[model samples]
Target: MEHHAPTTEFLGMTFNLSNVLMITIASAIVFILAVVTTRSLAMRPTGLQNFIEWVMDFVKGLIGSTMDWKTGGRFLFLGMTILMYIFVSNMLGLPFAIAIDSELWWKSPTADPTITLTLATMVVVLTHYYGIKMKGAKEYGRGFVSPLKFLFPFKIIEEFSNTLTLGLRLYGNIYAGEILLGLLAGLGGAGIAGALGAFLPMLVWQGFSIFVGTIQAFIFTMLTMVYIAHKVADDH
Candidate 1:
């Protein structure tokens, strides 16, 4: 938790170097996985294609559960992409971490508030954009005052709340996992008995972190769909 992300300047602006590097790596990893998963393009769809198709079906089901396929289908890519990217990014730093004193050179991008918050804000903004685009300004505006006029303020507040919760939930869980792992890593440096004592816990904790990463990714995806549904669902 005390580890500071790497910092650097680019074109006069300061940036978190560790985050930029991890984000780039995560993006590349996702792109490569996507290419590999779909490269064969088999009609029968075996191996990677089969797995990709299964993911597609999972996304489809997730969408169908929330809204019409027409509305939700368009977001399947967004949902799937976010799910994969966040999951992979969350898992990235679990196996190992690079640190020099208190400076963290590499870690999970999703564990950072900036990355998670940016993603949350972007998704919320898109929901508003699509809501107005699909339903027109008049109908979208009506959403704010639905049921009663007093709700306008609450509706406005809801946007910020949604964004904060979406991002913070992911950050909190991943950060906790990272912090616990760091403590365990410290235990490994103690003595022979400490090393033996910490080894099994570290291994078990890492596996649990993977589960945490996956659950957080899914939760983020599900909330994204819910937020979108609130904005774009015609019946809502």
Candidate 2:
């Protein structure tokens, strides 16, 4: 089994330099695009501003469809940020960066468990915060004990499982896609004949990977909206 070596280390931790650089670069690109897009808003939007607005509206509609507008409206920023960030990050790996030798860099950040899990944890924590705020301590506590007060243990387990699944699902899909891409790249490196044989298959895989990446981003955002809605809803 040939494994690509880690790029670099920092502060006693082994960090993949390429991944870190790619994430930083992707974040900056998104930030700049966002700033440029909204800098000159118009009554009749055009160019990048129009595209950005369209995407935002699309995300808003998705949220509205899942939950009431009042609740969904409040989460517009969250949904927009997640969708744009994930979309940009997913597309970042499409043009593999070249820095050292023929080594590929700039894989999707969400494909990494560390990145996906961090985002998932934030969503889970936000859900809990809103749950406590909206329902109050008393009702929040009561929610855990509803139907069967004696099942407090099971309720706690369920809460953790929900969050775990939220993170794991995104991680699994993105990671598997990344792994398949890596495997395809490996085939391309297996001498000249292998490289020639791998081209068509590689193209197919790359196209499929793009589709998978986009769907994963949408699913993650939808789930986030659902979780937050459930937390803040009166009937939950």
Candidate 3:
């Protein structure tokens, strides 16, 4: 069955109800996790606190590797938030997807090009904003012409390419994973023999999908920091 997204028209604009609902759920999950993780500050952390601290430390390291701590420290929260949110979003569809009356109501938001592209655009925009704020507008604009004036057009092209690749890479991986998983699910429902045959492949694919989702989250966060470093670093 081909399930279509439930959408609505509002203020002369179209909106995907499924995407909106999933995005809201993902955001709420991230928010609740953050609150729970920080609800108590312990001098000696354990359990969830320890886990979140470790994740934060990992994000800190990512920032440090890209730019000096003085500059990158400010982005620690951003990096951590991005990592956690995208990870949660990626994992949402792995368990199972929900389609109600030919409308897909639940899935990974990152599987949609609209969501991924918006995220990429936001990250790229933030990098430029920070670059201007740190380097001053004049100095930042000079970046396009530095080393050689002819590089300006190429640099402009690079920005567009970066945004397209960053967004499409995530969307492609997740969308394909979900499609295959859906097929496997259909196979599992066929009959006893089909269930037996599909079980192992489904299980294996689910695990691989988890791995891919985690990698994609990390890659997106890493690239975000790298882009910011290129924009804001003095030596760049």
Return the top candidate by TM-score.
Answer: 3
Per-residue lDDT of candidate 2, residues 132-228 (tens digit)? 9877988777877877888899988976887788778877877777677677777788889988988888898779878877887888898888888
Please, what are the lDDT tens digits per residue for candidate 1 over residues 1-236?
47776788889988998899899999999999999999999778889999889988887888888899988889999999988899889999899888887789778998899999999999999999999999899999999999799999999999999999999999999989998999998898888998999999999999999999999998998889988988999986
Worst 10 residues of 2 by lDDT: 95-104
Candidate 1, poorest ten consecutive residues by summed lDDT: 1-10
- Which prediction has the highest lDDT against the true structure? 3
- Tens digits of per-residue lDDT, candidate 3, 165-188, equal 999999999999999999999999
TM-score for each candidate, following the candidate numbering: 0.96, 0.86, 0.98
Model 3 bad stretches (over 4 Å) = none
| TM-score of candidate 3 to 2 decimals | 0.98
For candidate 3, what is the lDDT? 0.95
For candidate 2, what is the lDDT? 0.78
lDDT order of candidates, top first: 3, 1, 2
